[model samples]
Target: MSKKPVKKQDPETTGHSWDGIEEFNNPLPRWWLWTLYACIIWGIGYSIAYPAWPLINGATRGVLGYSTRAEVAEDIAYFKAANADLREELVAADLSEVANNPELLHFANANGRAVFATWCSQCHGSGAAGAVGFPNLLDNDWLWGGEIEEINETVTVGVRNETNDDARYSEMPAFGDILEEEEIAQVTEFVLSLSDDDVDQTMALAGATVFADNCAACHGEEGLGDKSQGAPNLADAIWLYGGDRETIMQTVTNSRFGVMPAWNARLSESDIRAVAIYVHGLGGGE
Candidate 1:
């Protein structure tokens, strides 16, 4: 028998499907919807209070004026203020006076030691043991005099700064300029001989006159260098420049210059005094 024709269904109301699946028209949970809305609101608030967006010229500055550098500067100023009185007292007192006062000297030395560790330690080394080009602070050799006043002056004005009136200025003329190369060699040998406990008497006898006429001006008549010019004493074993024959030849030919830095503006008076005391205490102090 023929089946009755299937009734036509309207597309809007039809629940027909090719697969075994059904569709439903439903709304999302109210809490979920509200949570999304809250996120957007919070983002906008954050942008306003904090640096969030990029501009053509620069990034936006946050409402709170916080900066890393400003904090550091403030900390430094606070520390400086805390030490102002001590710094003032140190500046007023003479170096000798500072040395005499045990309390002040101790304070000065503590400060100076720290400063020395930072600045002087690089060349002079820790404990002022010295290096290839640097002088040993523990020894009796004072290239420019070891007296406290002398050391203070050396630290203040320096050894070679032309601008400084009190700079320890001494120049050893190159004998090679006036003397023959053989004479320069002879004097160099003689200088070396002077430092040696067992030197050739014959060679030294010949070189003595050469030393007197050409070298005596800076390196005293006895080969003991003039400290006023930072000239190292040859009579002793310590040599600021060097003690080798080749080194002496070079010094004789080209001349030698030793430089000490000026610390007047950088360091305080008490600090320098402390350094002088510390240096003096190091076995070599007079």
Candidate 2:
């Protein structure tokens, strides 16, 4: 039997070539071209119908007059109007009495958690455990007083922040240039001895005198710390930074200044009260 002749087919190429390799001048599929053209038209229409161009002040409010911010504002206004009575009640009610009202308490806690997550969770952990330099809210140890009123005040005015004139203010003098190296060491040793039994006995003994002379005003003679001045109790072993000897020395040498913004500037009174109530109920409240 004789085999049939084979047919050969070749596509045209563009006049472009690289290293003797010809470029195929293939037309895009008809469906793809139509889709591309449709998209280009849709894009142009969308640009005219919505915000697309950027200006120095803001983006253009396109023909459709659509604004995401305006929508959000409307939604917020609706919610605020709906909850106005409850929020007013929350603001008016005493902090201690907030828990007694079931409806008020529920509203406050839910709102408070949201507020805390948005504002407080940045420094304090999601669980309010706190980070280094930040105070842990879950523990009974408090840099300032942990009472609901105190928490309200602290949240309202903030701590060590220059923005609020009435901010909870305290400054621990950096003892690096103030104290002699040996005195610093002795004081650090004494600070350690307040929490730990195992320390250099001689250094600790000398440190007691040094502590009395220098740190006793804020830290107390017994090293129990003064809450009025935001001084931490050294005897409790609860450290804002770390309890290590070197860390303590560094802290004494260069004092720590933690700043919290006055929430009153950003949040309403009701929101602040809600937050105070939420924090108080977090098991660390006095």
Pick the TM-score winner.
Answer: 2
Please provide TM-scores, in order, for all candidate models, with all chains considered together: 0.70, 0.93
| Candidate 2 residue runs with Cα over 4 Å from true position | 1-6
Tell me the alpha-carbon RMSD of every candidate.
10.9, 1.9
The residue-by-residue lDDT of candidate 1 on 1-286, one tens digit each, is: 9999999763452365658755543456999999989999998877777777899996666676655667899996896688777767877777666767787777777777877787788888998989876889887788778776676677778877666777778777776678888787777778878778566667677788898987787778998888766667887877666787788788889887767777776776656765765666567646
Q: After superposition, how far is residue 67 of candidate 2 from its true place, in Å?
A: 1.2
Write model 2 residue lDDT over 47-86, tens digit each, in one string.
9999999999998889999999999999989999999999
Instruction: Let me know the TM-score candidate 1 reaches against the reference structure.
Output: 0.70
Top candidate by lDDT: 2
The residue pairs found clashing in candidate 2 are none
